[model samples]
Target: MPRVPRPAVVAAAALALGTLAIAPATGDGPAVTDPRVVTHFDLTRGQSPENIALAPDGSADLTLSNARQVVNVTRQGRTRLIATLPEVANPHTPVVGAAVVLGIARAQDGTLFVTYATGTAETGVWRIPARGGKPRQIAQLPPAGFPNGLALDERRGVLYAADSVLGTVWRVPRAGGAPTAWATGAALEPRNPRPAAKVGANGLRFHRGAVWVSNTNAGTLLRIPVREDGSAGAIGTRATGLYAIDDFGFVDRHRDTALAALTGGSEVELVRPDGTHRVVLTPGDGLSNATSVAVRGRTAYVTSAAYFTRRDPNLLLARVHQRDRD
Candidate 1:
């Protein structure tokens, strides 16, 4: 991963399907059809939406790379302009949420953790109130480091931020103290077979106890254990061999079924920890170009980004549910 001097725009324009994949089936379970879009929101265009979070009870939140406005779409599907331009600071003049919140992650208790930047030459990370209110600075980052993807280790009180350009993962203790780097491919190899030079450290989430992130460039998922000191523990592979994996979400208890947006390869991958994934949605097919993903129980939701950047709108939130599975 070269020094990402600026946020890159590798948006998905279209995705074609070869054919529907073979459905997975099991004893007493209905035949598993490839995942499909449950519902979609096409009104949001050019917002540059990237990361997503679903509350413990299934409420949803959206974040964009460039939008400064933290627009809140409630679980009932009602839209609220929670934080507007001057409100978030409009760090990015083009989009106000520059003071705007991009990633909204929630702990089991509904405490919201937000990742945002001032959109200036320098940026900082913030912890915002999920229900509603002003945001507080969690950590101020060094130059050239824009914290992108975020995941919270609720049980441990740690907030993991993927400093995409730094090609590193950093942590801020919710309890206090300072933020520290967890890992750098410079010392250890990225979990992906791709050389370290190609791995983009982005999109992170907690599954079980591991901190998992999408190595966007190498097309792999990397996991590390939680450390009391915010150090990147022994590195390991969670899923790989898939073309591209953007944002992540899990559904079943066995961790047998999880979801992600495959932007490069163009599709929504219904994946297993083993790395083999069944295509649940495609853009050129019946689906749209999905850039990020989230899942809650019976459904999976995907987001397409900035219309000009993608054939899909900036915000296309679609749901994928288990209609049948054996």
Candidate 2:
């Protein structure tokens, strides 16, 4: 059974906070933060919106199923299909892209970079023009070098790929150069850790002088200490209680920390930046199997990945009012 979280003990995720705080709850809506943003991308169950990318221009892009492609979300979350990614598709095998979108980064020049997990014969990394264009494979990951995740240091032009199956993190030069091991299994595990290193690396995010990678097998996230010369090692685990984790995002700038959630949560549980976590929000609070979340500034839009059947659930977006709570 999925664990339930008490309303009083939110820990880090308690407040929607500051100018971005979520509104108080009311009977008119569900019992979550106010004006909650649900999936506006209009995707079917098979589309499997694995990874999403929001550019500085406010245009949003997300990866869909197959050795496939990403499409844009527009019309105020209206579900309309506009374009198909020809470059990322192979009609022979359709399920290739449904695995996981581990890394998402956009360059200063506005070129969007995406990294994939699981596998495919074509390539693991691709770049798309921000002005809207088909993605092209800039680098084809090695045969055995299964890159489960990816992130970039846009200022330095460094690309980091998490090698989940092989237990390593490799860096590839964004300008097109050889790939090198940025971190390995030996450097990722914590001494006398609550759990040992089984799968060394997953999920990559570049923030606060570190490359944060999620450990899927361990339900934890790790931050690797990095040097400008492309040298990196396991700094330490940043968060824990991450279930079947995939990707992570920062709440806002000027903060070294991030906001993350379980890509496949059975119910609500609170996970923290330092890897200490417990149940904070659960079924009783009116959330179910929340797989992904994105913040448009302070308002966070989450997804309920329960679209396995043919029917749409038409779930309502809920909010919490601060005044009502007090």
Candidate 3:
């Protein structure tokens, strides 16, 4: 989450969506649709779904941020506990108040990888076995760095973790090893360093020979080329005006179009290759502070954290339509 207060974000979200209400909705543009709520989580239990990874069996694996738990929500909305990260010796985080789990990614073999920000030596990347047992720390990150998003490059045997507070992306061996700072620059740093909750480089994904990242402070999406030698190349700004984009996923394999979750805007946007975008889903579609989105086949799964609404944190299922131009 950005270093801004939740209440402040709530106000911004409402204002942004209100402005979109008067915009024209063409057939090829943003369309209003009724999305199905798969399940509503208990906010008191800290069951806020932060990042999602879809399984082949139609189940979704998620990290319950404040709860420090990893769970699987099946197609039928049945949720099962996969693993709970061990408690941090110190619960306080640098910018955030408490220790929390953030991003999650699943491997083909059912193994799970996640990030934990504990503001202590324990803060780092963790791995849970496919058979389900204790979670082990694979790499230790900076105690003050808030690692917010994670992505695994299976082909390269590399795992990239984004540090929102540090404005850097760290790479670790998939099997477990020391992490190296893979990418860092001004584009990844928060505009204001003194803000309580300001964040940068909030989400990450390895796509098409580049690492796509979201800058919450700048409201821009960036693409960093992966060089032939597995090093990061120059960074390019792909899109802007994305208010509080938390996480996003590609809509089609052949197209660069993506469905991005706007946390502070309480909306889902369809971002095109040309950097144009339109709001596709909103509060009317059951979105309450959407945090992350995962697209599979013709379906799009969105997770609402409800950090601002303080009400229904839920998982929503919607159908995705492709444009003829793509």
> In terms of TM-score, how similar is model 2 to the real structure?
0.68
Per-candidate TM-score against the hidden true structure: 0.73, 0.68, 0.92
Worst 10 residues of 1 by lDDT: 11-20
* Candidate 3: count of backbone clashes, pairs at least 3 residues apart or interchain: 4
Candidates sorted by TM-score, best first: 3, 1, 2
Better of 2 and 3 by TM-score: 3
Off by over 4 Å in 3: 2-32
lDDT of 2 by residue, 286-317 (tens): 33434443444544444333322212222213
Per-residue lDDT of candidate 1, residues 185-261 (tens digit): 74222233222223356677777767777766556677787666646678786666445456667765445456767
Best by TM-score: 3
* TM-score for candidate 3: 0.92
Query: For residues 172-281, what per-residue lDDT tens digits would candidate 3 score against the true structure?
Result: 99999899999999999865444454578888877887889998767788999888899999989888878778899888666777888988767998887778788889
Which has the higher lDDT value, candidate number 2 or candidate number 3?
3
